[model samples]
Target: MEPVLPLVLPLRLRIRLAQGLWLVSWLLALASGLTLLCSGHLLVQLWHLGTFLAPSCPFSALPKVALAAGTLALGTGLVGAGASRASLDAARYPPWRAVLGPLLVAGTAGGGGLLVLALGLALGLPGSLAAGLEEGLGAALAHYKDTEVPGHCHAKRLMDELQLRHHCCGRHGYKDWFGVQWVSSRYLDPSDQDVVDQIQSNVEGLYLTDGVPFSCCNPHSPRPCLQSRLSDPHAHPLFDPRQPNLNLWAQGCHGVLLGHLQGLASMLGSMLAVTFPLQALVLVGLRYLQTALEAVGGVIDEEGETQGYLFPGGLKDMLRTAWLQGGAAHRPAPEEVPQEEAPPKEGLPEA
Candidate 1:
């Protein structure tokens, strides 16, 4: 197969390419950073929503969207910058002489910056801010509790009704009301069978005593009914029989887990966004510096073509010039010419 000739680009095209790359790099870096920042905010909002909304609703979905968008933007920017550096190197130098410093600086600075920012926003700032806001709101609401007499009255009445329904008279333990058991005994502690048996017996006995009708008993008795025997309401459970406290517990757990996951995703997204752009900027700066150094040092070839300044010849020249002009006494010897005595000896061979 015939080898394809390397296409020579016009000077305008080359300049445009450089400028375009620079512009894209800057824009992408900026965009990635901003997207990450926004993603962080969204993450915070999602967590805040989780406090009020059900886990399956906006609380669960928004973070996934933010994470997906932010990650895509960040990753694209980083990949573009890397690819641009590689292309630039390929165009400017021989394959073996291409420099990697610019690429390294660009990738590292941008990637690293984003990483740190994401972590800070996700783990530190958002969580702290949310907590602070929640605490402040709680305090404000607490202050208004006394002034809101009607609402307070309603709340108190509701509490009283709940207490009556649950058989929570403060004197009767939670175990008696909820059919739960507290086993402090050491032998029962280790044995699951014993624990279960104790809990069952306690719960059944408490439920039976509480559920059954009883007349007035002496308050001083150890088994005195703590609650005043008020008029009984509807005789069954307040909550639905099928769905119990288990549903509430499960919902709470789901919300907590979803919030944490969203926070993590947001943090990762932010990190990607901030880190790569900063790195690209650094690389561009380094490349600019290298170019400037080459120009100042007059490291161009005879054809007035400037190669990289830190090339082998340039470094050697710099060292040699520096040493010679650096006040060293040692001097280089001059070249010698052969005398005419050798030609005369050749002619004398005939003699």
Candidate 2:
């Protein structure tokens, strides 16, 4: 099969292609940076709730947030440098910059894409995640209380807030609070209970009656439920065997939180789908421009006519002709010239 011929694009067209590729890549990088920054802020707002659900979560800290922002900034800087070089000083533009810019963009996109894909995949397996959360979250909460003793007051406050806002209870249900050390331990504020009572009374006071906070009760109730019947007008209790239907909520926050995470994953996936192809297109267009530049350079000679190495056979044919001429110039003539008669007579007389 014949090899496909390289395109010989006009210089003006080549310049336009280069500029377009740069524009697309630059916009993609800039947009990705902004997306990451906004996502990080959102994560921070939701972080308090997320940690209550999964204490060991990696995104609980700010480094991962910083990483997302940093990668985007790096890619944008490299892309801008490459674009300026390509436009203002084409001859000085390093080929390495062409490669580096795409690599940075691809790396950022690929990493974030894979992270989102993994989150989506994990959440998609709701059965496994649900099973794990049932025992894992309960254990995490219990451990936090045991270590903190008396209670992890800050965590408890946050947990209560989360439960109220999301309409959830303990890990599995309101009953799970019974296992938490903070509620079960009798030595809450062992030293000078009367002295420390004023500041910590509201939180500690819940243990006076039941382990669960009023937040565990349904928010729709008219009054605070913990006071009596958790303010449920019908006075439905959580663990009453006969009143299962009147419970605050059967579903756990695990599912609700995971669903929100799934939305974030979808957002990242969409961004990846859009940016990855644009980055690839920029790389391919730059490569085409490079090839076209080389082709044009080879075709135009000193006399400005299409010359050596312009076509597949051009260089070889020129070399072959040169070889044949060199060989003929060194070869002996087919016919020999006769010697002069005087030279013959002089040779005889000497003999």
- Considering every candidate listed, which one attains the maximal lDDT? 2
What TM-score, over all chains together, does every model reach? 0.31, 0.54
Off by over 4 Å in 2: 1-7, 38-50, 53-81, 88-132, 140-154, 178-182, 187-211, 218-221, 224-251, 294-351
Candidate 1 C-alpha error for residue 332, in Å: 31
User: Where is the poorest 10-residue window by lDDT in model 2?
Assistant: 300-309
Residue 276 in model 1: shift from native, Å? Answer: 1.6
Q: How far is candidate 2 from the true structure (C-alpha RMSD, Å)?
A: 14.9
Clash count list over all predictions: 15, 2
lDDT of 1 by residue, 141-208 (tens): 22222333543333323323323433322112222222221111332443576445545676353211
| Residue pairs in clash, model 2 | 225-230, 225-231
For candidate 1, the C-alpha RMSD (Å) to the true structure equals: 18.7
Local accuracy by lDDT, each model: 0.41, 0.51
Q: Once model 2 is optimally superposed onto the true structure by TM-score, how far is the C-alpha of residue 153 displaced, in angstroms?
A: 5.9
